[model samples]
Target: MSKQHEKLRMMLTAALFAAIIGIMAQVTIPLPLVPITGQTLAVGLAATILGSRYGALSAIIYMLLGAVGIPVFSGMSAGMGVIFGPTGGYIVSFIFSAFITGLYIEKTSATVTQAFIANAIGMLINLTFGTVWLKVMADLSWAEAFVGGFTPFIIGGILKAFLAAWIGILARKRLQSARLLPSSTKLSA
Candidate 1:
């Protein structure tokens, strides 16, 4: 495909991934600090499949949609209140998580093991950012923040990270082999 075609494909893919993240957000076990949702899994998948810049762009799009009062969040909630709420840190952290995960996977040629590690690191970043935000925004103590926001989600995060790495690498390899996705297409300035 021509570079122009490739660029359009990337943009569409990013939008699709953003929607996927939004849909996944609906699968939530509502909690106090942060809802247990499939969002992190989708984030991992987007990063591995879309690469760093595109994955991060997709996350930004998702946030923008939510901020605009779109019912794209857990339990179909939306608006600026959600974006600036106690759990908003996790939402904001998604971009960095996707970017870091994608960068690591791209650099390692999307190796499965490294992908898992990268996703795990991304999860840690999310957990840390979300916890701090919870503490600051909610006026909770550090221990309370960690317990409520971080500790509660540890196992679920690991599972989602692993699933994202496994599924994303497989899908990416398939797309690459099909000539549907280029291996190294960075956005032009």
Candidate 2:
């Protein structure tokens, strides 16, 4: 494909992944402090498939949409209020999580194992930021934060990581085969 065409494709794909993250954010299981949502999984998938640059772009687009009151956040919540709310840390961390996850994949390969490790690390990053933010934003003790933010999500995070890894790697391979994605060199571009 032409260079211009490839760039367009990447931009469109990033937008699409942003939409996917918004949609997935609706898959929420309510909790006292931070609800478990599919947002992290979507972030992982974006990273694994789109690589660092586009993956981070997808997260940035998602955040911008939510900040602008697009109702794209979990529970259909939107606005800068959500961005500054107790759960805001997770939202902000999505950009970093996607970038790091994609960076790991780009540095190695998009195999399931590598993706799983990368996603797991991303999950930790999400939980850490979220827990700390929850503690401060919610005025909770460290134990409370650990219980409400960290402990409850560990198993679920692992499952989501594995799922993201498996599904992301599979989808990425198909996208590459269909010529919907650029070559490895272009992935980091």
Winning model by lDDT: 2
Write down the TM-score for model 2: 0.97
Clashes of each: 0, 0
TM-score of each: 0.95, 0.97
Which ten contiguous residues of candidate 2 have the minimum total lDDT?
A: 180-189
Candidate 1: regions farther than 4 A off: 185-189
Instruction: Write the residue-wise lDDT of candidate 1 on 103-186 in tens digits.
Output: 887777677788899899999999999899999999999999999999999999999999998999899889888877886533
How many clashing pairs in candidate 2? 0
lDDT tens per residue, model 2, 20-118: 999999999998788999999999999999988999999999999999999999999999989898889999999999999999888888799999999
lDDT of each: 0.88, 0.92
- List of clashing residue pairs for candidate 1: none
